[model samples]
Target: MEDRKQALVSRLLQYALIHEVLGIPYNEIVIKRTFEGKPYLECSKVGVEFPNFNFNVSHHGDYVAIASEPLCLVGVDVVCCTEPEKEPVPEFIENFSSYFSSLEWDNIINTGTSDEILVDFYRYWCLKEAFVKAVGSGLAYGVDKVEFHHTNWTNISVKVDGEPLTEWRFWLFKLPERHWVAVARGHPRFATENYKRTICKAEFDAEEYHKGLNLPNVAFVTRIIEQLIPVSHGEERPTMQDICSDCLHLSSREA
Candidate 1:
């Protein structure tokens, strides 16, 4: 399992190669940890080189995920559903209630469907997590301080203990049995006009991963990457298939 996890991390780094090839310096690369233990990559140089090129990555259990854009401040998380914790709701609310508005909680509790409630509950959790993750504070930032736009779920307005972050967007989606994913970017704009180019750019090519896996399993990794990326991106964001397909095509030509 350790070997597999390490291999997964290596495979995951290949996605970063796109940045490197674009003349983003490796020595200048910066990765930092938050007070609550979230990891953030610092691309001060990359940000300058391609102001529109924003990216973030998260991995959990069997999945590895990444998000990149021509320009945007972004954060992403991948959480596996195959290992749902057995924690109770009241306890969860008790610990995190300060984060939810009364209306939000009311909407959650009053909603009749169990799945809807569960999904909503997770929606808040993952969104908050993504926000803190975006700013590099992780869970140390109070969930209550970060408020989300109710209508679109993309806009975020933060009231942290010290200061406020002006505007940002939060997005959350499910990735089948493997995980739930979340993203935060420094834009309130969720319109698809800018997204068409981003989806075209952010992708993973599994052939690199294939070098270390069995032939049959190589196809499985490719399939999983294809299936999950689009779900995470949805209609508004670029699907993983679009990016990965481009990557594979490029690799084939070079070969």
Candidate 2:
């Protein structure tokens, strides 16, 4: 499972960095790991600094997710919405509730239904993971230190180290099915509403190397590649409606 997870994440990263971000083929990009084991692109190969390019990858259950931003730090996470087959929902929530803050626990209980509770659990879990990954500490930072308050699904407030943080924002939405995705990014470059989420379901033929890999049916990856390059609007300035017209068209298809 670990090997398969790494391979899938690498494939997604390659596609995202080479085709999406760099506008180059996969062969031209060189990837290196940081001292902390985080993967980053070797910008010198492209003859550009690429100081603003940042990305993060995560996989849980059957899903793998990747997020990238041209000029801001970005982190993303995806998780299955159902509990493990070995444990029931009540028992699973009881076991994991201690890891969440008091308000998070209350939010779960207020969900009222078992299915709703399960979804909420994964929602909070993904958000916490995304935030930690955005900070570049990964799990070593301990998710318990941060708390999330969601006034609504899209509107959220984060408190880390017992203080409110205004420079960060989060987005929570469902993919196609059976999964939830969350994103965390820095301020000024992108707003919460500007972030677009989509479900990309693509199959990679790994039968030659790995016979059985548990790949998810739905993958939640960002569409930030389109934002990296500037679009030319002949003479006249493009309206915000003209920019996000495609997004608005796809909004109806989102789950």
Candidate 3:
């Protein structure tokens, strides 16, 4: 279990290769907590000297994801559709409903399909989580300070601190095995950004995962890898590692 955390940290560092390109060293990466309880990294070695980069991470059962950007705050979360301990939905809704426009809740409650309803509900939850994370206050901001306008299944607009968020965007994608991921970013534009999203299966030879947290025997890690890796939907398959070796060989010739 401890090794799993190490592996995740290693993988996250690998995914943040952009920082290395910024000339930041691993030892120079400074992760600190804000007064609002959000965690941020100081990439001074990479030239982002002014505390401009922020990130958030979350895991469901086994899967985990992180988001980061230059000169902008970013928050990311992934939630497995597996129902959590049921509580009063209205209680939560009432607590933060004021932040939501009347039409928002109306549309939320009137979602035509169950899957759509569930997706929207989680979207709202993740968006709020990401917003609070972006604000560096976690739940201290009282979910009321942030609101989301779900224009459709894919598009969403956010309002924070009573200001319309035009410099931000949220992306929601469905992962295989009923998992969903969301990212909230304060960048001016994402469509033109150099973004790399990859979901690869890091094979474990001796079941390095699922040993801790006393989870069920049901296949959770496999499901998580499926959710993170970008592959044909509904196609459960494995690739030979020799394919990577072959690519490395071919690349050396070009170099």
* TM values, all candidates: 0.53, 0.66, 0.57
Ranking by lDDT: 2, 3, 1
Query: Best candidate per TM-score, number?
Result: 2
lDDT by candidate, in order shown: 0.47, 0.58, 0.48
Candidates 1 and 2 compared by lDDT, better number: 2
lDDT of 1 by residue, 207-227 (tens): 422221121111112234333
Which of the numbered candidates is closest to the native, going by highest lDDT?
Answer: 2
Q: Sort all candidates by TM-score, best to worst.
A: 2, 3, 1
Model 1, poorest ten-residue lDDT window?
Answer: 211-220
Per-residue C-alpha lDDT of model 3 across residues 1-255, encoded as one tens digit per residue: 133442343234332443444544333434443443344444434442422434466555445556555444556666666543564444434555665556567776678665565556776777777665554555556666577876665668877656786666677766776777677665422211111111011222233222211222122132233233323344432232311222222211010
**Inter-residue clash pairs, candidate 3:** 199-228, 199-229
Q: Cα RMSD to native, each candidate?
A: 14.6, 15.9, 16.4
Q: Which residue runs of candidate 2 sit more than 4 Å off their true CA positions?
A: 1-6, 45-50, 187-255
Clashing pairs in 1: 52-70, 52-71, 53-70, 99-144, 199-238
Give me the overall lDDT of model 3.
Answer: 0.48
Off by over 4 Å in 3: 1-23, 48-51, 84-101, 113-115, 160-163, 187-255
